[model samples]
Target: MSIELKHLRYADAAIQHGSFRKAADALGLKQSNLSRGIRTLEERLGYRLFERSNGGVQPTLAGRDFLQSARRILSDLQTIVGAANAVARGTAGRLRLGFYTSLSAGNLRNTLCDYARRFPDVHISALEDARSRLFADLRSGALDIAIVTGEPGAEFGTSMALWSERILIALPDSHSLAAKDALTWADLKRERFVLSLRDPGPEIEAILIAKLVTPGESLDVDHHDVSAESLKSLVSAGRGITVVCESCMGSVPSGMVFREARDGNGSTRVGFCAYWMPANENAALRNFVQMLEERCPPLQP
Candidate 1:
């Protein structure tokens, strides 16, 4: 049918104003154009929309039903348009983020809080998984972004250098090591260590072996299958000492204390980076990346 949205608008305006002349004035259109549009709309529906009146226009019983449907359609169209505009501006829609870091307190946590504050309408879906699974999700388009530790080797595609966090040792309150405000790798040489086989655990183990392992000396370390949360509880119960990132300090267990892990270089740390596909065109992802770049810019060479 040749009937268009303008015809529907014209009909609705005329009904609200109760006069073709007033509707045209309100719509900023010529009265003749408004009248013609209403006529076209009525003709399309094969019905008389208005009963002629000397004072003002009024909808016929049938026209009242038609106008009711027309007003609902107009309202729905307005909502659709508003949502579309918000999505285009990156102020709405969904953003799926993958990570393997503690959100207790860190740059990642701060960034998430700020982004949520700025774009409250945008839904943030976060997933914490092993590094390999995170990489796989990013590759399969299941995740828009993945924040990982160590380096910028986010295999699927583009990567950006983010902030690095200082490593810390989680010691029980009664442990003699807890007396030290900061500790060096050498201080942990004789202590028993407990680590999970999960993400940061494996990554932390690698650092431990690199720093402490030597030809003639052996360090005592045990591995378990548990989550970061459970690992902290185990340490609090004096199961064994464990290493953690600075973010873990935010919500340390009641019986545990976090001490800076250092070496000859001062504070031992692991760098973090963000990885995402360059081809993905999610507006929310784009906005998130912009915010990340602004807050944790890469070191300039």
Candidate 2:
């Protein structure tokens, strides 16, 4: 006696229409077939589900209980199907974007706005953290995609250098270096420097240390958001100078000046790269990567 969905469906229709003839019409089935299905269902359950009357039909206690469960099962099944369809269409899913401090301004913000406008149903979220944390989040599936500063030897499922811009030196407007169009690394040899401490990759720090007399005199600020603000304040107060990506100049506080670093190979550029898990195949993530490449072409390695 295998239970079937058609049996439950027939039972529900029969109860709704109050007679087998009417239920058959509603279901587009012959009256005899409908009556047989109801009879088989009642027999399998060892109970009389309905009381036949000349005027109408009424459900017995068992039929009433069965109808409740049948409706719930049907509703749940419909929901599952709808969710599957939504995912297939690239809508109604969550996307976690990993972004580093430097990109919060120009490229990252523009890309996010475009993605949101095009896919309004997708749930988009951002995790603003350092490079190392962003990579960790991607590896753990906490993030679907990350925009990080380039790391040469790090393991990644897929990565591309999105863009690069020269590093700039921020100084007080009254500082001696402010008179120059650009200041070389040598110009800041004796100047105090402020930098973000978290994951400033050894390669970049080593470059700065090689040019400065006392690289340890550099201040370790928490994150870029804080570091940038604090650096501007320190510069305004004539406490120190800092080196930052040119993009940071847009938000620099008043009384501070920004100039390209002299030793900066016009290409002493910071790289923006994207990373994702190779094995975790997701349509939304793939589409996002494509969008990034389309919006901002990658720089040649």
Candidate 3:
């Protein structure tokens, strides 16, 4: 016969207190009722769990073994309950995080590190991919949340403005502009611009046109569907100069140099946001999203 949790709890309390009356008083049950419960439990196991005397109740040899197991079982059950509570409170569980390229070095990295420290029990699985794949995984429920560039899309149930990085010009070492102390948009006017043919590529081009392009003047940009690393390789070969976020400077090739652009209003920056579906039922994801909201609130207009 299977032993019930109530039986185990009753036995443990009686053994710990060493008296049925005391255990019953502690558990707020009648002494007679506690004694009868123990009897029923012992009968089911076909053993005498306790020896009674004028001194008090003491465990029989067989009762010692049974009571030890009962205590251990109760302890394990308590631990399980505690863990479930932690999950419900958003302090423990698994978080699936998806991010686009170049997030590991900047604010996203710092934010994740802080989150892991704050909620040590949360198991975060981070994946990096292109914006298209990131958004797709977020939509399909393969990912709980995603850190992507540009504004949040219509598919996102909730979104937060994470951070932004100023745009820098990536120039080849041999390029004439590399010798200059600083670069400006006008400096790039005559230069060929290389851009990634990804989600932010068009966005970056638009920003360039808005900030740097003069009225009725044409800007030449070469779009390559490649990674930032690949883009650096192309830049090192002197294919064309490209604009990138400051966070990406460390990843540039040896022969390439990143120079700050002279935009007084600081409009030459790439914005990033975190997106998640409102229907996601994961407690860990909710916790992470709440933490992100606290850390990076939306920028006021």
Candidate 4:
């Protein structure tokens, strides 16, 4: 037999009040209507739910067991309704954010914290990856939105550039260059450098080769989630100095100091850009993109 929520609610109310008249009054239904509804429910279930008594009514054994189940069903229904409303209002849902290694500790961290404070119901998950992997994920639907460094000739569905900062030289506190207020690319011509293998894309490698002297030997680190943190540790131990985005200075090891590269103007600047599939735009994702644009204006592409 088909059971409806209305039937369950009426049964729960009747059992709670323990009388047809009281149940009807509470439910804003006439006593006769309430009586007939209960009678129909019992008939459909093929059992007598209540036993008529001299005082009024009492639940039968079957009725007693069914009352708890009925109440539980009604409670569950109410919870489902509440959750549905919350989702419909865009006040609750999950957001997956993809970010490159560099931004994870700087602007992205701050932006996510602010978003969480304002919308506590929204669940946010951050995934850190290299720029190439992040771009692939964004195109394949693996990421909702991603923060990546912009490429000059690459095509994207939709994107907004967030921040642009000149690359700075990270040197150990004891390094000779640390005493200098600022550095030029030529200043590091003879220094051993700790470089991430992933830092040199076709475009960036050309720039780096043009500026710094080829090191006799170097540490080739895998560029991943913990790569930057590990690189900072190496610099702190006085292993070598590396060039990184100026924003990364805030997160580098305590003993490390960052200096602006004097020739940084024409150098590759790190930028944060958000990209998503153009055809898959939803209200929440759209709002998030709009928020990024408002917070950080895009550079001319």
Rank ordering of all candidates by TM-score, starting from the highest: 1, 3, 4, 2
TM-scores of the candidates in the order shown: 0.93, 0.67, 0.86, 0.74
Model 3 TM-score?
0.86
Ranking by lDDT: 1, 3, 2, 4
Q: Write the per-residue lDDT of candidate 2 for residues 1-301, one digit (tens) a residue.
A: 7777788888888888898889899999998898889889889889988988888689988788977788889778889989877777666677888765454356666788888887787888887777778878888888898876665335867777676667778888998889999777777766766655544434355557755646356523222335455666766777677777655655777788888886645536676677888776666777788888897775558
lDDT tens readout by residue for model 3, 1-301? 9776787777889999999989999999998988898998999999999999877799999999989988888899999999999999879988999875564367787888888999999999998777779878888998999887786657657877787887888889999999997877778878898898875667778878886788788778898988676788899999999877766765768799988887666447777888888899999988888888888776678
Number of backbone clashes in candidate 4: 0
Compare the candidates by TM-score and give the number of the best one: 1
Candidate 1: list runs displaced more than 4 Å: 1-3, 52-56
Please list the residue runs of candidate 4 whose C-alpha ends up more than 4 Å from where it truly belongs after superposition: 16-37, 50-61, 84-90, 151-154, 189-192, 199-226, 262-269, 279-287, 297-301
Task: Please list the C-alpha lDDT of all candidates, in the order they appear.
Answer: 0.89, 0.73, 0.83, 0.71
Ranking 1 against 2 by TM-score, winner: 1
Clashing pairs in 3: none
Looking at candidate 1, the ten consecutive residues that score lowest on lDDT are 147-156
lDDT of 1 at 270: 90
Q: For candidate 1, lDDT tens digit of each residue in 93-200? A: 999999987899988899999999989999999999998999889889999999989788625699988998999888899999899999988888888889989998
